[model samples]
Target: MKQTVQLAGLSCQNCVKHTTAAFSKLEGVESVTIDLDQQLAQVTTDTAYQVQDYQEVLGPLPYKVESVL
Candidate 1:
C-alpha cells in the first residue's frame, strides 16, 4: 500500500527528517519521501498497512496532516 499525506507547518529539512523518522519506525513502512517544498510525504508500505495507522506517528509533530490519499 502507498499513502500520500499533505502536511502543514514544516519549515525545513529537519522537520522533514523528523517526520520521516517517525513514519519509518512503523513496522510495515518500506519507504518515505518528503517533498519539503510542497509539504507532502509519500509513504510506501506493505499491503497490510493502513493510513490510519500513521496518525499516531504524526501526532506529536508541529505539523498537522492536511490530507491522505
Candidate 2:
C-alpha cells in the first residue's frame, strides 16, 4: 500500500531525516520518502495504515501530519 502524508513544520534536511526515521520504524512500512520543499511524505507499506496512525506516530515530534491521501 502507498500513502501520501502531507506534513507541516518541516524546514530542513534534518526534519526529513527525522520524519523518515520515525516512519521507517513502523512495523509494516517498507520505505519513506520526504520532500522537504513540499512538506510531504510518500510512504510505502506492507499493511494498511490510517491517518490517525500516522498522526500518532508523529505526536511528540515538531512536525505535524496535516493530512493523508
Candidate 3:
C-alpha cells in the first residue's frame, strides 16, 4: 500500500527525517519518503494502514498532517 500524506509546518530536512522516523516505526511500514516541494510524505506499507494510523504516529510533532491523498 502507498499513501501521500500532506503535511504543514515542515521547512527543512530535519522535518523530513523526523517524519520518516515516526512513520518507519509503524507496524508494517516498509518505507517513507518526504517531498519538500509538495509538502507531502510518500509512504509504502505492507499492511492495511489507515489515515488516522499515520496521524497517530505523527501527533507529537510540530507538523500537522493536512490530508492523505
Best by lDDT: 2
lDDT of 1 by residue, 1-69 (tens): 888887789999899899999889988789999999998889898744445666677777887777778
Weakest ten-residue segment in model 1 by summed lDDT: 47-56
What RMSD does each model have against the real structure?
Answer: 1.9, 1.0, 1.3
lDDT tens digits, residue span 1-69, model 2: 888999999999988998898888888899999999899899999877777788778768888888888
lDDT of each: 0.82, 0.88, 0.85
**lDDT ranking, high to low:** 2, 3, 1
Please tell me which model should have the higher TM-score, number 1 or number 2: 2
Off by over 4 Å in 2: none
Q: Write the per-residue lDDT of candidate 3 for residues 1-69, one digit (tens) a residue.
A: 888888888899998899899989998889899998789888888776667787799877988887887
> Which lDDT value does model 1 have at 31?
94
TM-score of each: 0.82, 0.90, 0.87
Query: Considering every candidate listed, which one attains the maximal TM-score?
Result: 2
- Candidate 3 contains a number of clashing pairs equal to 0
lDDT of 1: 0.82
Worst 10 residues of 3 by lDDT: 46-55
> How many steric overlaps are in each model, in order?
0, 0, 0
